[model samples]
Target: MRVAFALSLLAALLSGCASHSNPSPDGAWINQTAIDAAAEGGNLRQALLAHGPNLEWNIDTKGGKAIASNGFELSEGKIVSAADGKLRIDFYGNSFEDLTLKGDALVQTATDSGPEQRFKAPKEAAPAGAQPGTSFERGLYSAYLGGKWSIVQGEGQGGVVEFQPDGSVSGLPGNDRYALCLAGDCAAMSGEYDSMWLEKNEQGNPWIFVRSGNQLEIFQAVNNAKADEMPDLRPGASQWVLQKN
Candidate 1:
C-alpha cells in the first residue's frame, strides 16, 4: 500500500499537476499541445502525464511564478503582465510564453489566432512520513536513499525500526523515542535520537525513506535525473540509515 501510494504520488507529480498553491493555481492545468508535441503522437499522454513535459503556475500576494518540468529540463519563472487578465512568463529568463485566464484555467497560444493550450489541476499535500500521528507497520526492514527525484533501490538500511500505531517508533538508532510529523512531503521523526526525514537536496527533489518489510528504501520522490550526483555515505556514519535483524 505504501509503495502504491508513493508510486501514485510520483505519477501525479510527473504526469499531472498534483499541485498546492496558496491561491491553488486555480486548480492544476496542462498544456496538452506541448505534451503532444513532446511525445510526437506516440499515445503517451498517460506516460507524459507521469514522465512528460508540464508546468505549474503559483500566483499569490508575494508574486506570480511558474514551474515547468519535462524530462530533465526544469524551467521556473515569474509571471509578468502589463494588461489586465493576461500573463507572459519567461522561463530561466531565456524565453517567454503568453497565457490568458479563461474561466478557471490558463490558456496558452502561440499567436493571437493560434489554437489554445490548456493546463489542469490535480491533488495537494504534505510529506507523508513526518505527518503527526502517522504510523508505519511494525516490522524489520532494509533502507534506501533518495536522489535526483527518484528512489535509489537497495541503497542500505534506513533503520530496523517498529512503527507503533500509537504514533511512536522503536529500534531506531539510539533506541530513542520518536514522534512523526508531516511538514513537507517528508515527515520528521523527532525524539531522543536523530531523525531521518525527506527534504529537497541540492536539487529540488524530495528525498525520503520508505519501509516495506526487509527493504527500507530511500528515494528522491520528485526528480530522478541527477540522483547519482548525491554524495555517498559509508555505513554507520549517518544514523539516518540503520540495519535490523
Candidate 2:
C-alpha cells in the first residue's frame, strides 16, 4: 500500500511539472494597439491604418534573433535577457523590453516606464505577396532624411541644418521657422519656412524636397536606402543640395 502511494505522488509531481512548462515564443506577433497609439499621437508619418495590421515581430528564440518593424523602419536585433530577468531585443543600440509571455499574448514595453503593449499571433498568414518588412519599407525616405546636413548649394550654401526623424528642422536661415508638412497642401502656406514633401525624380530616385519660402530645395540619396545603413543625400546645383555630416 505504501509503495502504491509513493508511485501516485511521483505521478502527481510529474503532471505538475508538465503543466508549468514554459511556452515557446517562436513565431510572428502583431501589435495593433501600439500602432493605433502612434496614429493617435499625431505621427503623420506613421503607417496607415490598413497597413498597421501587417506590421509584425518575428522572433526566433532558439536562434537568438529577432526582427521588428516600427511603422517607419525595420530593425533586426538579438534576443537577450535584461538585467531584471525580462526578455528583450537589442536593436541598433536601443533596448526593447518585456517580451513576457502571458497566456496567448506577448506583452512588451518600449521603455521601463512605458505602458504595456500587447501583441498576439495572427490566425492567418499575411496577404499574398506581402513582404515581412513591407510595412516598414514605406518610411525609408523619412529615415534617410535624418541627421545633420551641410548646405552645399542654393541659398543657404555655407550653413548647416539638422533634420530630425520626426520632421523638425533647426539651424536654417531666418528665425528658424519651419513646419512639418509630410502630407497635405504645404506649398500654399505664405510663410518663409522649410516644408518637406515627397516625390520621385525623373531618374526614378526617391526625392524629398523642402520648400523654403519661394525657393524649392531638392534632395536625393547618394546611395540606395538600406535597412542596415543610413544613406547620404545630395541635391541639384540649381536647388539646395545637402550632404550628410
Candidate 3:
C-alpha cells in the first residue's frame, strides 16, 4: 500500500507535464497577474516549489461585471476550489490560506450563509529537493536564467528584464533604473526589484513569465528553451529560445 500510494502521487504530479489536452490561453487563470506578482520575488523554481496556484480574476464583478462570470473574485472570507486539481482553499482577503500545503482539490459552492470551499487530497504532488543544498538539481533549474528577457507585458511601453548567465539582469523599457547580478539571489540584485514568473499550463512549452514593479510590466511570457529556437540577436547578439535562429 505504501508503494502504491507513492506511485499514485507520482502519477498525479506528472499529469500534465507530458502530452495532454492543453488549457487555452484565455482559459488559463495564472496569466499576467500571476507573472507580475511572482516577478516581485522572482524565484520561479522556489515560487513554484512553494506553489498553491495563485489565480487572477475579478469576483465582485460589479464595475467589471461578467458579474461572477468567472466566479474568480472573492471577498475576504471566501473560499475556493481549484480548477487545476482537487484542492480547497480559504481566503483571508489579501491572499489564500493553506497555501503550498500538500492536499487535495478544494470545492467551492454557494450556501445560505455564504460560499464554502473544501480541499481534496492532492493526486500527485510536485517533486522537491530532499535537502536544501542539492547543487545539481538547483543548477539544472536555474540554467534557464541564462539569457536576455524582454518585457512582453505592458501594452503601451512596458519594461523588460534580461537575465544573463554572467550573473547579471537588466533592461530599460521606460525607466532609467538598472541592476546587475551574479546569481539568482533576489536579495543581492541591484536596482529596484520587481518581477515574477507565470508557469506554463500547456505541453511542449517551457513557461511564460514577466517582471513587474512600480510602473513596469510584461503581458505574455514565452521562451526559446529549445535549441532550434536559438540564434544571434545582433550580428552577434546571441540566439533566443522561441524565435528560430
Candidate 2 lowest-lDDT run of ten: 183-192
In model 1, which range of ten residues has the least summed lDDT? 134-143
Shift of residue 32 alpha carbon in model 3, Å = 27
Candidate 1 residue lDDT tens string, 135-237? 1111100011111112122332332455443324454333333232222222222111112332222222223344343334333333323556543321132
Highest lDDT among the candidates is held by which one?
2
lDDT of 3 by residue, 106-157 (tens): 2334345333333222122223422211222223223434344444333222
Tens digit of lDDT per residue, candidate 2, span 144-230? 444567887766788887754333456554323223332223322312222343322312233345433223356432334366755
Clashing pairs in 2: none
Please, what is the whole-model Cα lDDT of each candidate in the order they appear? 0.37, 0.51, 0.30
Q: Model 2 Cα displacement at 218 (Å)?
A: 28
For TM-score, candidate 2 versus 3, the one ahead is 2
Give the TM-scores of the predictions, in the order they appear: 0.32, 0.38, 0.19
The list of candidate 3 runs beyond 4 A from truth reads 1-142, 153-161, 173-245
Between candidates 1 and 2, the lDDT winner: 2
Ranking by TM-score: 2, 1, 3
